[model samples]
Target: MKESSSFGNLWQAPTARRLAHATSQTSPADSHALGRLIGAAWVVVAYAARGVLRGYLGDSMQSGGGVPFWRCAFGVGMQLGVLPALLAALCASKGGGSPLFPTPRRLERWNEAWLRTPSGVWEWAFGYVFGLFFTFDLLLVPMKTNVLAHHVVCLAFHGWVFFSPQRPGLQLVIAGEAVLEFGTGGSNLSMLLPGSDAVRAFFVLAMSASNTYGAVLTVRWLRLQRGRWVWLTLLPTILGILALRQLHVVNEVYKRAHSPAPP
Candidate 1:
């Protein structure tokens, strides 16, 4: 009887040890998934709040009396609020692991390197082009308020996504914004004036460049895990650019619809 009890205990001990090991391995993965969900939820909420504040401030700006300053203030606020969050998320996602926010050390390193690279020059060029297009929207607002609003929204969202860690999400948002504007009679060329084609081309090129950077990084990380190819990261940018072109065509149609009839 004693021998039988000892044998049973011996058999159950290994099973218990295996169960403990399995649980230990899974806990971090579960925690990581939870963290990502929480982070995404926070982002959605933050954006929603930003939209409401933007509308309110825009109304104030339209009323004159130093209202334009408020618009600039809002722009600065958005940079401060969203950019840091994005950087945090990126840092958190390092180490081939899920992060709740950007790692401080990683962000510092990126900032240092980014400041030193020629890529910084291209980024500045894109920023300037975007700013010029934005100023043009202010002049055209009286002719097509909806189109103006669309451009403002697009520019704001693009800035958020460009600086954020979730580049794919930003690409999708920009593509969707393009579609909305195109549907409403906004023309990329008209918005950017003489350099419209060049502006659009630069955005297209930037999209590809950013996607390539993301894909290469993802591939390197996956290789370390001995995982299969994650092709969607590379494919989405192509689809996004196609969507942008389609949006441009739709915007042209809208413009024609609203134009004065032949005398």
Candidate 2:
């Protein structure tokens, strides 16, 4: 009994008591922080999965009686993800490095941007929505120029997969895409969104301009991680396309509610 009392007194000493107090006081802050971290992670996962499924099945460009292009879109998307993964695995098997975790030399400057990477929610959302819509857009244009225009723009979007949507690069891409579309008559989607051609053009241009200025920056911080971390960097870049079309859906519904009866 006496030994237990001495030990308790030792813990009650000023230094030990302060340490204990600090540890006890940290619990609420730590739990709150952990909760926030989990919430953000959940939101990101939802966005990525949303992007993939929507890319596979969502439709954007069709107006009336258009072919259900999503069926074909699903096939194309499967090819995009599956073919690359399989090829990487096959190459890794032959070379003796795991496909997922590539060698340091193979990935250059991957770790340099880890702190600034996004969770790839917007990018995937952009791709899936664009693919679903553009597939229909391609079908709408009977002329060779329009078809070629759509093809080239979509190809360029795919290329952005390698370039992180670090503000400067993403801004340029959006401006470039809008210009290419307007020049190529791919501005066809401009008309479908509850407005006249002039209004549509204005809206498209405005949205593109806004995105160049507005989309949230992907790099929340500057972190140095391993090179395999580059793959994570590539993701936000790839998935980080404009979410204008998706956001427009909400805007349209809101307009419809307010002006449900247009004479």
Q: Cα deviation of 34 in candidate 1 (Å)?
A: 12
Question: Alpha-carbon error at 28 in model 1, in Å?
Answer: 9.4
Give each model's whole-structure lDDT.
Answer: 0.37, 0.37
User: What TM-score should be assigned to candidate 2?
Assistant: 0.25
Candidate 2, residues 33-96, lDDT tens digits: the string is 5434544554454456545745775655343213233423332333334333322322222223
Worst 10 residues of 2 by lDDT: 216-225
Which stretches of candidate 2 lie above 4 Å from their native place? 1-118, 139-144, 160-263
Clashing pairs in 2: 55-128, 115-223, 116-219, 123-239, 123-240, 123-241, 124-239
Q: lDDT, candidate 2, residue 31?
A: 33
Backbone N/Cα/C clashes per model: 8, 7
Report residue 40 deviation for candidate 1 (angstroms): 8.8
- Report the C-alpha displacement of residue 153, candidate 2, in angstroms: 4.3
- lDDT of each residue in 158-220, candidate 1, tens digit only: 565455442332212322332232222222223323235554454344433444443443333
Clashes of 2: 7
